[model samples]
Target: MSDLTPDRTADPTGSAGVESKGGDRAQYGMCAGLAGLGVLLLVDAARLAPVQSSNDALGPKPVPIVLGVLLLVVALFYAIDIWRGGVGAAEEGEDVDLSAGSDFKTVGLLVVVFGVGAALIAPLGWVIAGSLLFWGCAFALGNRHHIRGLAIGVAISLITFYAFAIGLGVNLPAGILDGIL
Candidate 1:
């Protein structure tokens, strides 16, 4: 029998039948990255001021601390799994054509749109600039309905503007609509 063929007599499940030459070492990089991110989060979270109020109890430390610990635990488990000769399964049910080249035209258009949005932000403001950005992105991605795209973009931008300004207390530039906004 060929080395590539699984030994059906060894195990019915076929998992332990075909021995991998060596477990994938690439997964260890992900484990390291997760651990690094966890450490960074813990450090950053530690730097936050422990300010407590009647309305906001527990401050801003618990969430990051919990997330950091969770990440560390996950990283540890992932590393252990990798050590046990675990390999990721191949993706299934996708109809992607791997041979097709990237569509640079759409990418270039999106870059231009993003640049234009950034340039317009200071002069036209977040609402208008964001609307243009959203619409332009949709157009670049092949959305043909100009009026509908524009309306949707406007609504999204307006909602985000209000959400950031009112909900988060972060002031996005009002620009031309300074007094009105």
Candidate 2:
């Protein structure tokens, strides 16, 4: 059989050494998860029996359909990558660490932060909850600028709150700030 090993010093696809499989698994996993989520969304959309609710402009179909289509596109790309033997340019013999200690820590912190933020957002209101999310993320990501980070986080939270809550007129739970917002 012809050697499957790509030359180490040479570009694999003849492109300018543009890609690596370093995070291909992660990307694939994300895509798979998204595709699964899309399937769920599509199912839910199908099950959506129209009912009279306070909010009745756009039915449940729109968001779910949009999400499903987008997710399907992402899934297609990921599957293509897998079919192409991943995005790795390294030779067949070359080895790399797909999982690292820092990666675990980062992923763990992200899960915790998202879980806590989602749980707290309703009870704490957007501003406070968002501030917590922002500051917590900066800390988790090993940001060094303590005050600056916090400031930036708070600013982001406020801006996001204003844009989504105020500008878009989307109804987000006020939680603690129910009367405050």
Candidate 3:
């Protein structure tokens, strides 16, 4: 029982009858950053051309405007929650051990993979480029089934391309598969 006791009495960070937890200043920084992003989104939405009164109220502009407003509201609420002395919940349930230090190698690999995909997009087009991005990200994140990942990624990208291009009336560059796609 003596071994389980905490020597809080002698700790300078705490005082008698008072409990102290180290401040999560990072929360405040994150809140501010989110608030800034909300503002930027709102500004960008404002720059979008207004729909003619004849057109339906629901358009590209309204969705982004609503999202920006919601982001601002959420950021405000989070800041208030933090100001009221809330502590963040400990992260849990990830496959990786949280006790292990940061994995910079995996992070760098993911960044490089994403960069390569983005660079390839212009020449390779949506289906192939997006497939590479998806498969590369999965591989970087520890999925080792390269063939399975590539197949799944290519299928997803093709579905997404057709869905957006045919259903939504959006034009995606088809690149080498141009006429065939």
Which portions of model 1 show Cα errors greater than 4 Å?
A: 1-23, 49-59
Q: Clash number for every model?
A: 0, 0, 0
- Which is the better candidate, 1 or 2, if ranked by lDDT? 1
Residues 1-181, candidate 2, lDDT per residue (tens digit)? 4765445566545333334433335457777898999899888888988866777767667888899888888888777776554664544543767453357888889889989998898888877888888888888889878888778877987788778877988876667777766
Candidate 2, lDDT over the whole model: 0.75
Judged by whole-model lDDT over C-alpha atoms, candidate 3 comes out at 0.81
Q: Look at candidate 2 and tell me the lDDT of residue 166.
A: 72
Q: Give lDDT tens digits, candidate 1, residues 1-181.
A: 3456434455443345323543457778999999999999999999999886887789899999999999999999888877776665533437878568899999999999999999999999999999999999999999999999999999999999999999998999988999998
| Comparing 1 and 2 on TM-score, the stronger one | 1
Q: What is the C-alpha RMSD of each candidate to the true structure, in Å?
A: 4.9, 8.1, 6.6
Which prediction has more favorable TM-score, 2 or 3?
3
The collision pairs in model 2 are: none
- lDDT tens digits, residues 1-181, model 3? 1455334446443332322343345677888888898899999998988677765776578877888898899999887766655654433347976468899999999999999998988898999999999999999999999999999999999999999988988988888888889
> Measured by C-alpha RMSD in angstroms, how accurate is candidate 2?
8.1
Decoy 2 TM-score against native: 0.50
Determine which window of 10 residues in candidate 3 has minimal summed lDDT.
Answer: 13-22
| TM-score of candidate 1 versus the correct structure, residues matched by position | 0.79
Model 3 clash pairs?
none
